[model samples]
Target: MPDARLVDSKASFASFSNVLDARLLRALADLGFARPTLVQSKAIPLALENRDILARARTGSGKTAAYCIPVVQKILNNTAASSSDSQSTRALILVPTRELSEQISAHLRGLVTYCDKEVTIANVSSGTTHHLQRTLLSDKPDIVVATPSKALALLQSKANTTLVIDEADLILSYGHDEDVRQIFSSGYLPKVYQSFLMSATMTDDVEQLKGLALRSPVILKLEEDEDEAANLTQYSVRCSEVDKFLLIYVILKLRLIKGKCIIFVNDVDRCYRLKLFLEQFSIKSCVLNSELPLNSRYHVVQEFNKGVYEYIIASDESIKKGEQDVESEEEDAAETKDDNCDQSKSRKRKHRHKGEGDKEYGVTRGVDFVDVSCVVNFDLPPSSRSYTHRVGRTARAGRSGMSLSFVVPEKEWGKNKVVGCVESTKKDEKISARIEAEQAARGSKIKEYKFDMKQVEAFRYRMEDALRAVTRSAVREARIKELKTEILNSDKLKAHFEDNPLDLEYLRHDKPLHPARVQSHMKHVPKYMLPKIAPVAGAEAPADSVAQDVGFVPFKKGGDRGRGRGRGRGRGGKKKSDPLKKFGR
Candidate 1:
């Protein structure tokens, strides 16, 4: 490893010419990347020099390209210098989630498009058969991307290999500490090799990984520039439990928020509940959660980026549960027998079904969501860290974005038990306070946004009717139905879609999952029922006489001409004519 050094600040590279190969520079241009990001500009030069690096940069700061360019450049350089014809795995990239492994592999493929004949990569984190993975590894691909568990089988000493751990902080949180220990202690790492530990935050777990994986490494902590910081605007709305649903319905149905938006919830059940609720209004949205198959999850993200769906209801359930597990253990240690019993039941209810919600899946940390215009936190996260990552999905790559969070006031937490979440009821206020403090510490603020309830009141009864239909049983049925549909459409028709591109459009994820009663009239907003536009300030005020003369009619007509029991026919009890029903006559 190179001697340790600490650098505070530096200018970004003007271009990718000096540090990157011509082929890589061409690929960058083709991919529409104008210049190197701050982290990329600084780390690429040092990494090319074979220096170990511990770098911290926020999400969407181009950290993937920062390390990938150097790795590819070094591989190209090594192949040119060596005379051996035998191919071998020279670089190993470890990520926390399967989604991240796939994302990195895709990016690497893009970077190596012009040089695919010479460079090859494999992603072992993909849920393929073990036999197939072993076969792929037996061929000795140039680069291997995997989760720590997947890399366990491939941890053997190889000469001049490079080790890169992306999202190092999340690796341990995903419960891979033992796998990490085995890799580091197995004595399989090459004596002379470059190492990179990349993370978004400097957590204790990250420090622990650094000690095991790096020696005398240079530390680079890059802060977001002024432009980057100004791109994101954050707001929080205080509302009751039912109001959360009402506000989201109004915001989405009325197009108050535009462009692709990600609505985040705290658990798996909540994902389907919100999805089913939105479906009542004929608003289509896809669901992305850990319970779904890996292929389906990846495909959903792909479709979202391509604009096949405008809204996605996602769950950070696994990540939140991971944090909750540790906290619950601490509470159990200090609490009494009654408290322990209650927690035991809660655990059972949370984990009723295995191989589903209880996995290492995470949407907040590593998955890439492109061009998100807004993030709606249907349920406030359990911690400030979770909140940060949830909101980080938007305002990426210098594009403007907005984040709107629904905070349940303490007094209104459980007032409406039907739509209330236990976790949110117990911890929302505290978590919201911490989030505000954390943001303020970082020179940002989360302002309170108040929606005019009187104006939104017209939609409340409709929201109630919609909410009534989304019972627990209905949510469960929808969840199972969607899973079965995804397996059929995504897995069974995977080959067909590949061969026929146009057919992929018919494979929609946002199709309505209507196990509950769906009312056709609820689909459209009536003109008169629409919220009236507020009068602009400084405009001419209507005279008192004119204001008094105005009637309840929305249109300019004789108001009471059509409002009579007789209907201008007679005061006799006669059957009203139905022209459509008597069309045959």
Candidate 2:
């Protein structure tokens, strides 16, 4: 296993949050920071000294200020580094998600403005376009706040400078190994340009990056505060998958948590859906995900910071490599995100300058939603380190917080690990049973109620797959029927129609009509207008005159059967005959 520990710890400041530099001090005072968090006090001075640093600190532990202070101080000391020009980016701070970057940048903006300086910090993350990030990287800026892949592509462009991979180990072990290599290999980052690696877990790849990227880099360590530790109350709940969501909803209803909170899910789509469900009860929520546009993701975070949204659903493990159900680079390479194999000796190797092929990785250590009041897990993280990271979002920077991790029955993590965090919410007999029953009930309700989301998705894909091949014959009859059934089953879909059910007369049928016809039309148009188009054009027209003739006729021929049949038909006596063919009856 790689040594996931920060090797060097020399503390000039007692806390990572301390701002010792005069200008930084002024900014801090202006921003209302009373004192340094342990990590900040130590990491800041080391960073100011321009060392490749690997520091372990929890979220809200003032880690951002720990790194931010030094970078801002460096820009103040060295005018050449802070440039408005696009290609001259002095500092590149890579975070795990766009939301974190936006949140941090907002804080940075406040500090810089108070210090009477103007600086631009751009966020490059999934929710945003690669093109925009490339443009920024190509043009360069004072500093770039980005996710690994986005930054790596820019760095690979050889628009090189300082590289600071916050949560270096997280990125390397989980997400963006290939991209990290590109950044690591992207030409010379001179001594004047600094490298800083910050994370709570010091996995080996991060240490290697520190050694290879920094020149005589300094190291710092901060111990968690005793008071903060005492203040935090940790606990867990054991339940089935369904119960977990219900537990969370009940927790919310009970108002057991205070301040803004973050709930960590394993997937982005889940987060999005959860946010919607929470909103039904008048609770404002937001989601942070890779699929959201970068700026949109950024703004959602801004809203979180501004307290406009009460809860933000964050999937800490989603963006990482190897961890996702989908195969990623780390998994492809037969490694986990926190792989500590091939850890170098603690005796710092002087800037080996190994490139991408040398096994690149990053850490998710630095990206955290600070000051979170509570952390609830939809599922236990892949490992203990991930568990810590999820819980770390709360109880950070000397602040007190609590956590509630929901462990579903038969989930990979058993009862022991899930209940380990709680000092008081220990495993017991009836509570566990209650929790499990709740989970089953929630799931049963969801399943029994006829909401088949996956089917809906599959149907969508099926239509896309089949629709493009619309042949001369009808392409949608089966699909349409299937979709109609699905719509009838879906609460979301049904609610949509009930609100606007084509308002057609057929929709007004006495039997709470399925309005299958109206639904089919409403599927294509407004509910009220469904009847106007659904009856098949000319279906109501006079019956084909030839229909009065022989029961059947060849499709292409028979010369307008209605016309033929009408002329052939005699009053009352003879068998129906066709006018065109003199058939004996």
Candidate 3:
């Protein structure tokens, strides 16, 4: 059974004076936290009694404070009772990202400001000087907030009494489950200590992690209020691949976005590409990707919060890699290098692509941006969970916001179909099946998530109307010419265009319009234009239209089709050919 100090559902922060330390209560008051949030009220008391907690709450629900307050209270009480070394670590907080670790550290410092006892706190993570981390850990602080991998490396000497994993879902998603297990089984932590796992979304993976980490834990699942979703306006726009940038430009030009906005892309390359495209239109923006140095990433975030840039584009790439993996790769490369100088240079070229691997960290879960008014999904996220996290950046703390996603129709680049598979050969059957199964599972989960379908449809219609209006507006022609002149005159874009002229082809020619398209476009045309314009006659067809015709051709399956002709043809045939056998050979 949990401790009696656990607060009731209706209890406020002031109501917990009997259970909470006086100094902690004073600090909370100074921070202007009069009432406890649902998670904080329920989880704090149980945590103070050394109870394990598995909590599921929405983002921006004060979950950080829920865990931080109890941990601090426990540490203060323990230090007061015993005259132990003030620098010894008692609590360890593990987060998925360095940004989150910094945020938690800052919040902990705020909570400890009013305490009479000197409570020391330190943040250890990658991208910081190794010597600095060593110095910080040498004189162990009362609380240490760190990424899982970094914590495991620096925590060999301390036996912490409590462990808190914030954004537990993200830890599993980044394949850091093993790193987490290593921390628990590292023989450094106490066998019996309080553990807390908090997440915005709960899934089977989180359940599995709970089984592995907790014992007799109290589960607190706070249902998100309908008012939270009511405050957010979620919608999506359907556009072709080539027109996506144009659509975004139109939206921004029309002043559809309000206040500060965040644009999320699926990978780093697209993140930069979108930034450059926006720059061509004289739209100033900054980018947040893993390739930037840690200091630069921090500066970008700081500047973004200060309103230095209206749009900050971020990538969803996982940038944390194990130190062991990095060391082993370097050793193997050194061992395989030939004595010849040219051979060494050739080897370097061969491994050039590997340099793109996740070598630096980027923004992820638990980082908070203040007063964000909108979140734009330049690329659709691969899962519903990602979608939730991206949109959760806005409408925080009961404020109203909006989220817009661009949905592009899938297309084929060549003869092969764009069905998720690289090839349509029989050898890829298993791989294709696995891909389809995963996609189907994600699709089912998204449907069950229950977003507002009516609102989404209405938003789509509105976007269509906006697109037509922008396309037919008299200012569009002048705007396009002005944009072209700017792009050609700007030194940065001019050089880029010289190197990659194909990127500007879309702007060079006006796309031909079909009769149906013209009719739809006419709906948005001004009344003055309607009187001057007339539909094209059939005789006006260009003589070269027939020459431009390119009929569709069906994709032919690769490899031998007859039975016994291929290696994996018949039931008695040789073992099925491995799809990756070519790379090995």
Candidate 4:
């Protein structure tokens, strides 16, 4: 159950109509938001009163509107108080990703559409040019939704009266803690301003941010509906590394995947690789990663929503470009270069600097895809929290969804030693431990669902048959050619390679070459009909051996046929006892 104080059964947007301005109510009506979600009902009123709020709600439980409504209303109130000529940015909303920033900005724009006062809003993120953002900021929009790095950059010149950190848990996860800290501690903004921290999970990192950023905040914890869990059918498949993709192909071929699906990989390279592999099967799909331009990403999402594509392979790469650390070697080289040479190189670099698409902020968090019926974990998420977020992509807004995960069995090292497939390395082990601890701390559990072995075998067979249609050699060659062309054509890659020719050579030399598939001789043979290895001549026969009774000569031991030691007899003629005899006694 949710906190009793936060769950008002009679709570509606109209109930707060007296408190809210007429324009906002009209916007809500136009948007068809009849009732306030649990978080909205509780957090909205408290936020309207200008109280700092730390809130936890389910992923699709209207947390955005909960904070956005208050921030909009507050900005409008401040606007009404001041002169119409005054247009200072009053509210700042910081989200984790560009997709989320745009989403929030769009929603806020819709909400303030019918407002009497002209409430201008703008969104600033890494995808677009800083010049355009600066131009937009020069207008002094009443509210600005932005990513942390870009927001921090903008806040240096433009200060806000209110701050909202949506998906606060992701702020730390995406390594924006420092940017966030700078905004709060940097005297550029007001010493005292209203703040709101909201997320689906109340992580320790979020709590720490609350202590550092917010002044005495009101905590609102909303429970997830158990029925929502029931709405999603979770399942796991035990598979090998190679078989995972095969299984995916089989699932797709069989039409087992329902509606719009997202295949989530841990890194960008894997996402691209999987997309290419799916293409070999003639399965058309789009990719959503940081590598694509923001507009392209926006377009991909729109197309996906319109059923233009059945599947979109996404990656969990969330490191922003401004946050990337420059290599010391590059710095040293730059400092040692001649003035004229440096100027020439600078001009070349300026020419090469096309845009910010070179940055690798892959799609992990803050992406909401509509009608996502299923989420497939092409690779297992590093942590339980990641798993939660990935699955939360589906089963959103009270809709039923499904999540499927692939778990590889631990490999045996020796008779007694076993190693995990995913967490095989030390760093992976540490990360897995941290994820487990985080999940335990938050009381999150991953429910396991059983799958039938016959169905699995059938799928495997179908996958193997599908693989035969596309040769690994051909796919590898095609992929290599495509990559080489991409590298040669890309200004960023060409510039990077020019800086380090050895790296370019390495890329050419290390072009992906998948091993040729070998046909197994025993693949189609029945297990019972397979020939067994012949017994050694010196080995003792079985106790019920038909060969021994048919006058088969036994091998001599130590070249002494008459005085040989019998089976199970030691040199000292002692009989061995069971090791568990003591326990039995």
Q: Model 1 over residues 1-585: C-alpha lDDT tens digits?
A: 222123222532324455556787788778877667888878987887788999999888889998998899888888888899988889999898888998999999999988877789999888678888888888888999989898897655365379999998788878788888988788767777789999987888899999988989999999896656656667888888898899888777867665789999877788889999998999999998877777778888888998889999998764344653245346546654554443465568766755555265778887889878778898888768778888889877766666888888877766775774555345577678878988888776786666656667888999999999999899889989998988787564446776887877677889999999999999988865664433325666555543222222221122222321111111142422211110011
> Which is the winner by TM-score between candidate 1 and candidate 3?
1
lDDT of 4 at 135: 90
Taken over the whole model, the C-alpha lDDT of each candidate is: 0.76, 0.48, 0.59, 0.61
Clashes of 2: 53
- What is the overall TM-score of model 2 with all chains considered together? 0.56
Instruction: Kindly list the per-residue Cα lDDT of model 4 for residues 424-533, writing each as its tens digit.
Output: 11122233344445544555433343333343454455345445534534544544554444444344332575587455323321122333232444123233322222
TM-score of each: 0.87, 0.56, 0.65, 0.69
Report each candidate's C-alpha RMSD, comma-separated, in the order given: 12.2, 25.3, 17.7, 17.9
Tens-digit lDDT track for model 3 on 432-483?
Answer: 2332354345331111112223322323443443334333232234334433
Q: Where does the lowest 10-residue lDDT sum fall in candidate 1?
A: 576-585
Predicted candidate 2: what Cα RMSD to the true structure?
25.3
lDDT per residue for candidate 2 within 266-353, as digits (tens), equals: 5433544454334333345655544333433444444465566667776554333443222223343564344332223211221242
In model 4, state the lDDT of residue 159: 54
Report model 4's TM-score to 2 decimal places.
0.69
Q: Which structure is stronger by TM-score: 1 or 2?
A: 1
The parts of candidate 4 lying over 4 Å away from their true place are 1-9, 157-159, 318-362, 412-585
